[model samples]
Target: MSSKTYAGIPQEYAKLETSKIVLIPVPYDGTSTWQKGADKGPEAFLNASENMETYDIETATEVYQQGVFLADAVTENSSPEAMVEAVHKTTKHFIKKNKFVTLFGGEHSISIGSIRAFNECFDNLTVLHIDAHADLRKSYQGSACNHACAVYEASQTTNLIQVGIRSMDVKETTVLDPEKTYFAHELATNEFWIDSAIDQMTDNVFITFDLDAFDPSILPSTGTPEPGGLFWYETLDFLKKVFTEKNVVGFDIVELCPNKIEKSSDFLAAKLYYKMLSYKFMGENVEDDYDNTYESKAQKNNVTKFNDDEY
Candidate 1:
């Protein structure tokens, strides 16, 4: 094993058994529309993550105190369906171990498998989809598994609450629930959008965040860049509320297409990943967090407590 892992933390804290969270990197770049460099997204995100401070100032907690096991990135293949299946199985593996799993991706289409795994694990799942594009097409270019159909299965099976959506196909409107879908144009002056979005969710939520949800100025390293997207603080505020008010089962951040000139986007992805972990664990701390045998401590403190049915 390479000694390096997420947060640049010591190996003891980054090992699987002792950690409360797992970082699954899926560097699979398939079905991208505009950019082709998304295959390097996970690497750039992890490289930037190594430089981040473990302590999250906004959440007032050193979230990395809860050990974070950064697993090896998922192996890429020519077949996109095979890649998604791999992600689905791997994500479910860690979740069964009672780990708080999160994934960073190569493209928006990569979310389909992760979402499927979360659906099987948790009941009454409310998918909080934060993306610039609706991604509700029944099929794109002959594949329902395309980036355009990222949330198609979720919309059919779960309570899908889409937010920060600024782009959509004319046909997508047919499947999209207007009451639950919060559009970026309509939200320019609405402060209650966040509250209403969360209200539409169930107790267990799975977030599928497409990086293009952010404005191109703030986050240009994405497969598709949108003109007017979410800002840093506004996005974080909504996320914090969601983490605080609901049970975030798991999440995946996808669609980062890295570049050499714009390294800030890479850093942003890393910081965003850490910040999400911090918010999720802010109020769920356990005992002996730094101990070598911390899994027992976690159970003792009821930190990672959950029945199979609750998953």
Candidate 2:
């Protein structure tokens, strides 16, 4: 299938209707240690998105109908501190218009700037971090604002809840609050308390997802792959619950390194973006959009099969 571009002007900004959501693509990856091409992630995801049917199967809504705008990619190269200032200025412009921000990242470090912007508009914000590593180090490779310390910088802004974490160094362990950190092993083995973990979140949430939070089996294109992380449905179920229980104001999806050999990773990331949009905005009305297509037929057939199996 051919790649899809957003339905607006190229590179500057594209708006649909009143523009409740804006996608800011940050294609800068100077500090990545292992993988080098994550700077190309935004374009790859956008290209893959062209083939995605706008309708969501689970939510049953065309979330794109909510009006998504794509902002130009931030391509500046400077110190992490300077980059944060640039992101802050740009994000503050959007926040002034009351638009919800969805940041597409070059690496996890990009979130530091975005979250800094968020703290200005929100007071009781809590971060929901989905990552393979704890990322709680105070500094890494001589930079305090390194990608490895993204979560650490975020915690300075607000309370944090980290999930799907499977790796951490001894230094990270010392700084992190044991109560707020949930390891992937705990989530996989103890399914009964996922709700309890999510319940600890504040009413206003900022979700930051590192692609490595997913099992390397499904998403192997990240810079640092970790095994035994979340599966698709498991992570989605948790997100659904979080959306239902809390008010998610903004979010970021980071660390996607598009590999030509396995294009599924890019497509999956694109689909996940739409799914989150559907859940956040359409809610129960998600299934209402299915009045006109094969999707409705498929959903009905699945429902019928499920009912028949119950007997």
Candidate 3:
């Protein structure tokens, strides 16, 4: 029952706290095709979180004000089915305690387990998926419960609205509903489509973000880096709209393969986690404040102490 300061809280129980949010780290990566080290993702993301500021400049709120309790890391399960059961049980416990569970994943496969937990409590829930790959394959290699089939398993429990999808197999394309799926290219070309995409989702939404959804330039630590994908503000704006218009029950951030070479990806992931909290609680008011304060600070800090003439 290790604890740390999160959002100004000096000392709080990891999961038992009445905090608004809980971080559940799932360090299981059994079905990665390209990258093998995704099992280490939870610790990497947690380490990066230590350096993360409580203030979210983009959301204009110290999201930690909402109270984020960092739970103990979940032990890795042997099989996907076991992992799913573990995640489902843990999430149910959190939901019962009235805390919003934000699962930190070892790979995409962890989502199936988390979603199962949510399904036990919420009826008529919909999943809003953000990923570069469709992940609609019934099974990959020999496992139907592979990380590549996370969304496929989730679809069994709830309706799905997939976004930022740039890569998919022909088989997945055939099975997925065209009306429900929003491709990354379509989102890029038509800014107004975001609203239309959100409209397709049910009010009770569970967001699952695979870090690879962003282009490799911004999120290069993913196992499979897609070329063209959502930018920072683009993704944030879409999420803002979702939280404003829909009831986001919970979310999971997955597929972060930390690299010693680039630290930005880890920080970006941590900040985004906090930003989601701000949007869910503060809504549009927070966004406005964030922009005003962040922009003003940038302008104020632009000047150097040393004169340019010295060069």
List runs of model 1 lying over 4 Å from the truth.
Answer: 286-311
Q: Which digits, one per residue and each the tens of the lDDT, describe model 2 over residues 176-246?
A: 88788888888767766578777788777889999999998988888889999889998889998888788
Where in model 2 is the C-alpha error above 4 Å? 1-17, 284-311
State the lDDT at 83 in candidate 3.
82
C-alpha lDDT of all candidate models, in order: 0.86, 0.77, 0.78
RMSD of each: 3.8, 11.4, 13.2
| Model 1 / residue 141 / CA error / Å | 1.4
- In Å, residue 67's CA in model 2 sits off its true spot by 0.4
What is the full ranking by lDDT, best candidate first? 1, 3, 2
> After aligning candidate 1 to the native by TM-score, how far in Å is the CA of 203 from where it should be?
0.1
Question: Which runs in model 3 stand beyond 4 Å of their true positions?
Answer: 5-9, 12-15, 283-311
* Candidate number achieving the greatest lDDT relative to the actual structure: 1
Q: Of the candidates shown, which would achieve the greatest TM-score relative to the real structure? A: 1
